[model samples]
Target: MHATEALRRLLEHCPELDRTHDLVRQFASMLDARDAAPLPDWLDHLAVSRLPALDGLAKAIREDQHAVVQGITTPFNSGVNEGRITDLKLQKRIMAGRAGVPLLRHRVILMAGLRRSYP
Candidate 1:
């Protein structure tokens, strides 16, 4: 049988997997909808579900619940900040040991914020 068919049969027999699947879907929907209000209920269920595999995930979300909520609700993200950090790190490594602070700074200033020519 196909993998999906096997999983379907297994899920029919495994109530735990069924519950986990439903909970995961609800969590995914909450993320897509940026709805934080339902997070506590979901976490509560996850905690009592006793799924040892997901303990770390639960812990992280609990520790950063506020940030998680903000992340879900806010349109702002760290993409730009991460990109700039990457660019700066790359430029610094390239210029390392060859230049002093001023030249390194100049090179970083010149290289960053510009698109690479791929010709």
Candidate 2:
């Protein structure tokens, strides 16, 4: 299902969760409406306050300058790394679930390193 619809379903199912989910759904709807255009002024302001480094980096990019913007606009994400770990777990499960902790740790580390080096 599309992200907006999925989010709507989730909100419908859990009406008492944190409000951030609703905000996210609204943001997604805005993006869909605008074809994922640049964030609107209000959203930009909110982002700037919440993430100063991103605001600074955006300013620099606007001025045709580049600099290390750590803590803002991370160059990589841990999602792929987490996925790799999950995949490793599944593979180990197929092998009678007998992989030792050390071997699993080594395999995950090696795979993460390789992914970073190649990707």
Clashes of 2: 0
Per-residue C-alpha lDDT of model 1 across residues 1-119, encoded as one tens digit per residue? 99989989998999889888888998888879988899988888887887876566777799989998998788888976787678777877776766777987777676653544321
User: Lowest summed-lDDT stretch of 10 residues in model 2?
Assistant: 65-74
| Residue-level error in angstroms, candidate 1, position 116 | 16
Residue 12 local lDDT, model 2: 80
TM-score of each: 0.56, 0.30
At residue 60, give the lDDT of candidate 1. Answer: 78
Model 1 residue 77 CA deviation in Å: 3.3
Number of the top-ranking candidate, with TM-score as the measure:
1
Please, what are the lDDT tens digits per residue for candidate 2 over residues 1-119? 99979877887887543244544565566544543333344345434544555456456644542222221234445767588978688657765767887887777787677778988
In model 1, the runs with Cα more than 4 Å from the true position are 1-7, 78-119
Each model's C-alpha lDDT? 0.80, 0.57
